[model samples]
Target: MGLLPLNYRRPDHVSEEDVRRNESSVEFDEKADASLKSGYSGTSPGIPDALTFDRILNGGACPPCTVRDFMNYLIYIEHAAENLQFYLWYRDYVRRFDAAPASETVLSPDWTRAMEEDTIARVQKDATGKAKKDAPVARELFKGTDFEKAPEARVESRDPFATPPRSSAGDTASLSGSQATSYVSQAEDAFSAVGVKQPFTIQPFRSEINRVIATYIVDDSPRQLNLSSCEQKAVVRALSYTTHPSALRTLSQNIENTLRRQAHPNFIRWSICNGNPARVTFARGLGVGTILVAAVGSIILTLSKAGRGWRALFAILWVLGIATLVAAAKGMCVVLHGLHHRNVRPWELFVEDNTTGLEQLHEGKRSFDSFGSCNSYEDEPWVVKYQRRFYVRKVFDREVWIQEPALRQIQDTIFLQSVLLALFGASALTAIFVAVPAGGFF
Candidate 1:
């Protein structure tokens, strides 16, 4: 039966029609194969292509990774900013408490020197009662104020009974009053003075910073599975500049053009794939992952060894190396240096929100002429109306169409999936190595 089937499959005789059919079939098969390879690999076989370093960002296709990375970056950036602010605050507090001149002291050489010594002492104080009492008042009142100042004014007056009364002394008499009365008048004057004292206004706590920071995180992190246009530019440039000179000239020119056309500084610097927050956020995640993984590995290694000093040292060194590599990868040290240059401690002050007007600008369907050129439209698009009617019919009649966190939800999902998949893959690989052979591996 098998032989008969094989015989039936074989061609009995070669004819023009048969040859044509065979050739056609071969051609079709070739074409299909080519299509499949092209679709899946996106490259010809045996040829090296540009590395897709950008796609690894935010755990490609994983929405949860995207959300996790985005949120983590914001938290990290904010924490860094807060730490910087705290340091600044602490430094100012120390200076104010230590070197602050007596509120009423004259600034002679001795006094100035004494104030300087006092400041030093206050910064390095023992737990003494009197020093502690004075520190708080000085710190609160003179926080971040200049430490050196001229002496307080002295008002010398003659006793009313001792001074011989004369018409010429009328001006002095007019100025004199009971000490309580004078104190009241002085207090009133101090209170009424139009900006006599420099207004100790706290620097405006800009809520805008938070929004910008958030936007920076979101735009920089991975939004989708791939790098955004801006992120592609950054990663490509980074790779090209580091390795290939051929890409430099074209990249530089494109970078210049992009800078001219785009408002973002990253466009000019070729630092991001797209001006979008998501892609940038992903790049940052890559760096963060390396650091975290290294640290975790080191901890696990150290823990695995029960009080072994050499193993702990090796683990520590390995972790440190990983940390250094991560810092190098993400330009963290450079960023820290830049912060220092600006006299900023990144961990001190923080922003709360990060969205720009771009969101508002791009949110809805815009109006356009018949040619599809965008124009300002007073009327909302019918699609919006349809969506409201079909999906949100009850809420459609309302004037404001409050935004749903559709993108955020998507990001969250992707992030979670990526993390789970990664963990699963890692666990499977570990299990294979640890248990598949079922021997003495562990």
Candidate 2:
């Protein structure tokens, strides 16, 4: 809800278990966290890097990772995109519902009270602190809620896995349509409007709710979401009563959690194994390091006058080169790690705070900046997106310091692992070339 969230009136419509996870703070099992461990092989089924799913969801600095990028990965790679598609659509729908004119939103006496209360509560929570910083800056875009700082600003977790706290005792924004005239259109109708005025009230979004139900909630329907009957009914009932976004809230929350828990980790794994920075960075490191290794081998084989003692010294260069190559293979650049900094990807530029000078983050003809734009997924196709190399793209990447404690630990771990691997390789090579009585080329 921290991203200008859905109204958080406790759901009386569904079982408590269904909405239990929707609360503000999540109690994470410390042992289960993959980030706590830094020896990531990019081979774990669980995401083992410093980056967490909730962090990515909260718009953390995971490059080439965005709503669109994730969606494309889901659509093309995982073959499971319905949950994310419906979830995105639902959130976008909520924005329109909020931005709808107040006059048009007056569905009934009961609706007016609930909507007003929800508006006030949402604005109150989003008006200050870290949540407010990333919350929609366009307060003027919303209709009913006067964006004011609540004296005691209710802080919400940015974590999708975490549930927001229940509303106060007096927060009775929850209402049944019995308070309204109960104007419902029970007919096969299309709700195919993407523009602003589509989700207002009776004539506007009842059909859209029906459409969403027909598409995503109905069992075995095309693009059907894996929703429990209770969840589906809650959404149908709430949206039918009024096109308020809170209706879709439960369903969206579940879908969001699903995407975060399952699909996201798989995407990260695929990214590491296939591309992102793994192959590209590895190649760069390998090319440079291999040159040094070749030079060491050439000197050892060609210089017969050199004693075995000094021959072992040449292994030091091999160790350094192999370490660089190995580090990059593990998604770490040894040089960057030593410097305590990393290059920022173009897509990741906008993910930072305003203080990072991201006002002009999007510039190129292929910028993935504009959401709902025609060229959104053209940055790279998902089919071979991760397969993309960094040579041409490195110009877009800027050097940024790795300041986060967790990430710093991860980079250090990778560098150490790389050095250890290099030591082993160097020992083996020196044994064959220097320790053994193998004659030099000369």
Estimate every model's Cα lDDT from 0 to 1: 0.27, 0.48
> What is the C-alpha lDDT profile of model 2 across 324-441, one tens digit per residue?
7765555556656667666654344444556333432332322222122222233432224324645556533556665445445545555666677778888887766665553554
lDDT tens digits by residue: candidate 1, 82-157: 2112222323433443454544112211213243344334423322333456556546666665632311111124
Model 2 segments beyond 4 Å from truth? 1-51, 55-188, 191-254, 266-303, 348-397, 438-441
Determine the C-alpha RMSD for candidate 1 after optimal superposition of all C-alphas.
31.6
Candidate 2, lDDT over the whole model: 0.48
Count clashing residue pairs in model 2: 6
Worst 10 residues of 1 by lDDT: 1-10
What are the per-model C-alpha RMSD values against the true structure?
Answer: 31.6, 19.3
TM-score of each: 0.17, 0.45
Best by TM-score: 2
Q: After the best TM-score superposition of candidate 2, give how far the Cα of residue 348 lies from its true spot, in angstroms.
A: 6.2
